[model samples]
Target: MVTRDDFTEERIKKLEKNLLKVRKENRVKEIANKMHEVLSGKIISVDMNPCYLNDLSYMIKKNLELVREALKKNVSDEGSTSNVP
Candidate 1:
């Protein structure tokens, strides 16, 4: 019983959903890349001593955790706002 208009509408909705998914993926990648750049710079500046290397390792791990949490919060916030009627 579906008409051409109905099919077109469904197609458009699917495309919109895909677009949103792709945009979110791109956003996550951008955040990760920025984080990588910052971490690389920090790593390069650190001294080669064992103590400094250990500290840098810890900092990298902590920063990665923070980035994950931030990205999760961001994605959740975006989902909540984007789905508004």
Candidate 2:
């Protein structure tokens, strides 16, 4: 019972949904890349500043906590996607 226009519309909707999913994945990758750069810079600073060792440890602990949370969220996202059929 689907007309030509209905089929085209459905195709367009699916394409748009796929595009949105790709964009979201790309954005997540970009954020992770930026986080890596920031973490590297922090490590370099810590290496250069012995006096800031305590601060570096604190920062590292906080960053690790954030990374753990992010990883958990990522795992959940992957799990949900895997369940899709």
Candidate 3:
């Protein structure tokens, strides 16, 4: 014994699920684009002084890791907010 309301509710839920999937994909795409830009625009020189090169290389790696983590946290936060009661 199903009513029109039941069908509508199911459809809404399915659409919401699909929307969330799309949002997550878009976020990943945006992060990848930003990462590509950062790598392309900020080139490191191989002939740089050894002392400075090592330190700078470590810093750049750390910064990129931080950026990736921040982006992940942002996506998680957005998803959580959407589920608020």
Candidate 4:
């Protein structure tokens, strides 16, 4: 009972859905790359010094906060394109 036009329409719909999926995947990869770039750094020496420990802890917390903000911004930017859960 399927006509040629119907078949073509179905194919087009499938392709559009696939394109959207690919776009969403690309967006995720972009976000991940940005996060990696933000977090990448030289390895620091570890010692028993309390000051060093405090500085390391602060750096980690700051990096995590930056990542969170970046993710939030990305999610908001893509709000119309995809649903972020």
Per-candidate Cα lDDT values, in order, are: 0.73, 0.72, 0.73, 0.71
On lDDT, the stronger of 2 and 3 is: 3
User: lDDT for model 4, on a 0 to 1 scale?
Assistant: 0.71
lDDT of 2: 0.72
Error of 2 at 3 (Å): 0.9
Q: Over the stretch 5-76, how does candidate 1's per-residue lDDT look in tens digits? A: 999999999999999999978865655564476666733444456754565466568778998999999999
Comparing 1 and 4 on TM-score, the stronger one? 1
Off by over 4 Å in 3: 42-85
TM-score of each: 0.50, 0.51, 0.48, 0.48
CA displacement after TM-score superposition, residue 40 of candidate 2 (Å): 0.6
Tens-digit lDDT track for model 2 on 1-85?
Answer: 9999999999999999999999978865655554566666733443445544444455557779998999999999888876657
- Rank the models by TM-score, top first: 2, 1, 3, 4
TM-score of 3: 0.48
Q: What are the per-residue Cα lDDT tens digits for candidate 4 across 1-85? A: 9999999999999999999999978865654554455458634445546754564466567778998999999888888575556
lDDT of 1: 0.73
